[model samples]
Target: MTEPTFFETPQPVDLATIAEWAGAELVRGDGAAEITGVAPVEAARPGMLVFFDNMIYADRLAATEAAACLVTKKHQAKVPDHVAVLVCKDAYKSWAQVLSKLYPAAVVPADPGPNTISERALVDPAARLERDVRVEAGAVIGAGVEIGSGTVVRANAVIGPGCRIGRHCVVGPNVTVQHALIGDRVYLHPGVCIGQDGFGYAMGPQGHLKVPQIGRVVIQDDVEIGANTTVDRGANRDTVIGEGTKIDNQVQIGHNVEIGRHCVIVSQVGLSGSCKLEDFVAIGGQSGVRGHVTIGMGAQIAAVSVVNDDVPVGGRYGGTPAKPVKQWFREVTALRKLAERTPST
Candidate 1:
C-alpha cells in the first residue's frame, strides 16, 4: 500500500518569517533566504531548516547544508559561515514553534475533506450536531448525542447515546466513546476505548459477584490521550481526567481514579481504583499505583516503580512500595557494594 500524506503540503517560507515564528534573533544570515522544509542537522539540505542545540552533534552541524539553523547564543560561533544562524535562548523550544507554524494541519486523524459532513456516515436523526461539525465516512453518531461546532469525528468512530463532545475535538478512527462528556480541544487518538466498565467485583466462596458500574468518564479541555489507551468508567462516581493532563498509550486507568490538572501519566502506567493524583504530579513509564492511595501535588514517581502508599507533597519516590528516591538509590548502591565484597557460595 502506498503511504498517504496526512498533513497538508507546507509552503516555502522565508528566513525572516521563520525567525519571527521562532522568536529568535537573525544574528548572522540573510533574512531574504527561502527555506522549503525542516530536517535534522546530519541530513539537512539546502533550503531546509535545522537545529543545533548540543555540542555532541558538532560534526553534523559543521557539515550541514541547511539554509538556516536555530542555535543557542553559546553555539552561534560554531555554525558554519555558509549557514544562517538564528540565535535563541532555547533552540529546541524555538524549533517546536517553527514546526507548528510550518505545519498547521499536522493534527492527529487528518481533517475530513472540504465538505463538512460525509454522506456515508450514519448519524441518527435525533443527534444534535452544531454547525461546521465534520462526520467522516463510516462514523456512527448515536441518538441524543450532541457534538459541538468544529469537531471532527473521524472514520469508523462511535459516539454512543447521550454523549456530549465539545468543539474543536478530534475523535480518531476506530475510537469508542460511551457514557462520557469530552471537553473542548480534546484529542482521542485511534483505537482509544473510553467510558468502558471498570473492574469491580465482590469476592465469594462459590463465585465472584459482579458489581454494577454506572458512572461516566469526564475528560477535560485541552487533554490528549494517546492511541489504544483504556480508561474505565467509575462504579459509583465519575472517572475524572483533569484539564491539560496528557496520557500516553496503553495506560490502564481503573475505576474512580482521579487524575488532577496538568499531571503527566507516562506509557504503560496503571492507576488502581479510587487512587488520586494531585495537580502537577508525574508518573513515569510502567509505574503502578495502589488502590485508594493519594499522591500529593507536585510529587513524582520514577519509572518502573510500584507505589503502595500515600506520597507526600513535592516528594520524589521510586522502587517497589515506592520510598523516597534518594533513599532508594542509596540502598541500591549499598547492596551492589555488599554483593561485590562477598565470596562465591
Candidate 2:
C-alpha cells in the first residue's frame, strides 16, 4: 500500500513556541531553533522534534540528531548539548501535543470533486443521497439506500439496499455495508465488511444446518472501524457497537456481541458470538474472548489472552483461561523457578 502524502507541508516552529504549546519548559540550548517535523529518536533529523521516555531507547536518545527533544526532568541529563530540550512531566504526552500542533489533521472535502463521483459510478434511482455527498468512481449504491449529507462513499464501495448511513460518515474504499444502521461521523476504513451473516449453525447427525441471520448491525455515533475489520450481523437480536468505540485493524466482532461506549479493541482481537463488553473495557491486541462471556466495565484484558469466563468490573486479566493479572504473574514466576531447579536433560 502506498503511504498517504500530507497535503499541507509543516512550516518550521521555534522550540520555545512548541514548548509553550506542549506545556513543557524550554530547559536547554537555543529556544529559537526551528523544528519542522516529529519523528522517533533514531529516525529524527536536524529539523525534527523527537521524544525519549523509556530508558530502553537511551542509546537512540543519546545519538538523536533532532533539532529539539521532548524529555522528562529525569532524562534531561541524557539529551545532547546541541539538541534543545523541552522538559515535561510526561514526555510522550507532550510529544503528542507538539506533533498535533505541527501537523493537524487534514479536512476532507464533502462536495464531489473531479476525482469523486465519476460518471462510471452506479447509483440506483431509488437511492436517497443527501446534499454534498461524494460517491467515488465504481461505487455501487443499491436501491433504497439513504446516505446523509457530507458522507463520502469511496471508490468501489458497495452499500446494500435499505442501509442507512448517517451524516459526515466516511465509507472508505472497498467497504461493503448491508443490513446496517450506521450513525453520524462513523469512519469505516478500507475493506471493512459490516452486516455479514454470523457463524451460527445447528449441529445434527445428518449435516450442520446454517442458522438464518435476520438481525442488523447498529453502529452508533463516532465509531471508527479500522481497515479490513469485520462486524458480523446478529442471528436474532441486533449486534450493536456503542458510541465512541474504536476497533483497530483486522479485529473480528461476532454476531449478537454488544460492546458498550468508549471501548477500545486493538488489532487482531476476536470477540466471540453473544459476548457483552461493558463500558470502558479495553482488550489488547490478539486477545480472544469466549462465546457468551461478559467482560465487566473498565476491565482490561492483556494482549494474547484467552478469556473463557466472566471478568469482574475493574479487573485486569492476562494469560490463557485468563485470570487476574497478579495471580497470572505469580504463577509465571513459580513455573520459571521450578524450571530452573529441574535438572538438565
Candidate 3:
C-alpha cells in the first residue's frame, strides 16, 4: 500500500524573503541565496534552512551545509561564513515561522477524493452520516452512530455503535473509537484507541474479577490526540477530556480521568484513574500521575517525574514523588555533594 503524503512540493524561497516573513534581520552572507527546504543542522544540505539555538549543537551548526540559518545575536558569530544568517530574538520561533510559511497545513477537500469514503466501506443503514462526511475504504461504522458534517473517518477505522462524532473531525486510519461522545474539530491520529475498558478488576480468591466499564469517553472541542494513544472508558462515571487539550503520542489516560481545558499532555505520559487535571496543566514526556491526584490549574510537571500527590496551582514539579522545582533542585544538589564527599575503597 502507498503511504499517505501530506506535504506539498518544496518551493524555493530567497534568504531575504524568509527573513522578512520570519521578522528577522539578514545579518550575514548573500541575501539572494535560495533555500528550498528546512532541516536540522546535522542533515542540512545546500538550499536548506536550519536553526541554531543551543550551544551544545555548536559543532553541528559550524558544519552545516545549509544555504541559511536562523540564529540569535549571541549565536550569530558561531555560524559559518559561507551560510547566510537570519538573526532574530528567538531562533526557534523564527524557524517555526519559516516552516509555517514553507509548509502550510493541507486543506481537506470537501469533494470526494482518496480521503473520502470508498465503495468498499461498510456503513450500517442505521448510522446517520451528515453532509460531506467522508469514510475511507475498509472503515466500519456501527449501528446508531451519528457522524456530523465534514468529518472524515479514514481507512480501516472503526466507530463502534452509539458513538457520536462532531463536525470537521478527522478520525485517522486504523483508529478505533467506541462508547465515545466526541465534539467538533477534534483530530484523532492513526492507531488511537478510545473508550476501551479501563484497568479495573477485583482481587478475590477465584482470581481477578473483571469490572464492567459502563461509562463513556467525552472528548470536548478542538482536542487533538496523537497517534497510538489510548483513552479508557470509566467504570461508572464518564472519562472527560476538556476543550482544547492537546495530547501527544502513546499517552495512556485511565478510567474517569478528568483533563481540564487547554491541558498539554506530552508523549508517554500516563494518568491513572480518577485523577483530575485543572485548566492549563502541562505534563511533560514520560511523566506519570497517580490515581485520585488533583493537579491544580497551570501546574507543570517536568519530564520523567512521578506525581503521587496533589499539585498546587501554578507549581512546577519534578523528580520521583514530585515536589516543587526549587526543593527538588536543592535535594539533588545535596545528594551530589554527599556523593562527592564519600571516599572510594
TM-score of every model versus the real structure = 0.91, 0.90, 0.86
C-alpha local distance difference test of each model: 0.93, 0.91, 0.93
Per-residue CA lDDT of candidate 1, range 1-345, in tens? 999975666889999999999999999888988999999999988999999888999999999998899999988998999999999889999999998888867744555666477899999999999998999999999999999998999999999999999999999999999999999999998999999899999989999999999999999999999899999998999999999999999999998999999999999999999999999999999999999999999999999999999999999999987999999999999999999999988
Candidate 3 TM-score, C-alpha based? 0.86
Would you list the rank order by TM-score, best first? Answer: 1, 2, 3
**Residue-by-residue lDDT tens digits, candidate 2, 1-345:** 998975566898888899898899998867887888878999998888988989999898889888888889999999988888889999989877776776655333234464346688999999999888889889999999999988999999999999999998999999999999999999999999999999998999999999999999999999999999999998899899999999999999999999999999999999999999999999999999999999999999999999999999999999998999999999999999999999999
User: What TM-score does model 2 achieve against the real structure?
Assistant: 0.90
lDDT of 1 at 307: 96
lDDT of 3 by residue, 1-345 (tens): 998866865689888899998899998878887889888999999999999999999998889998898999999999999888889999988887877777766333234464356799999999999888889989999999999998999889999999999998999999999999999999999999999999999999989999999999999999999999999998899999999999999999999999999999999999999999999999999999999999999999999999999999999999998999999999999999999999977
Give Cα distance to truth, residue 248, candidate 1, Å.
1.5
Badly placed stretches (over 4 Å) of model 3 are: 1-8, 23-33, 105-115, 205-209, 343-345
Which residue ranges in model 1 land beyond 4 Å of their true spot?
1-9, 54-58, 74-78
State, as a TM-score between 0 and 1, how close model 1 is to the true structure. 0.91
Deviation from native of the Cα of residue 313 in model 2, angstroms: 1.2
Q: What is residue 40's positional error in candidate 1, in angstroms?
A: 1.4
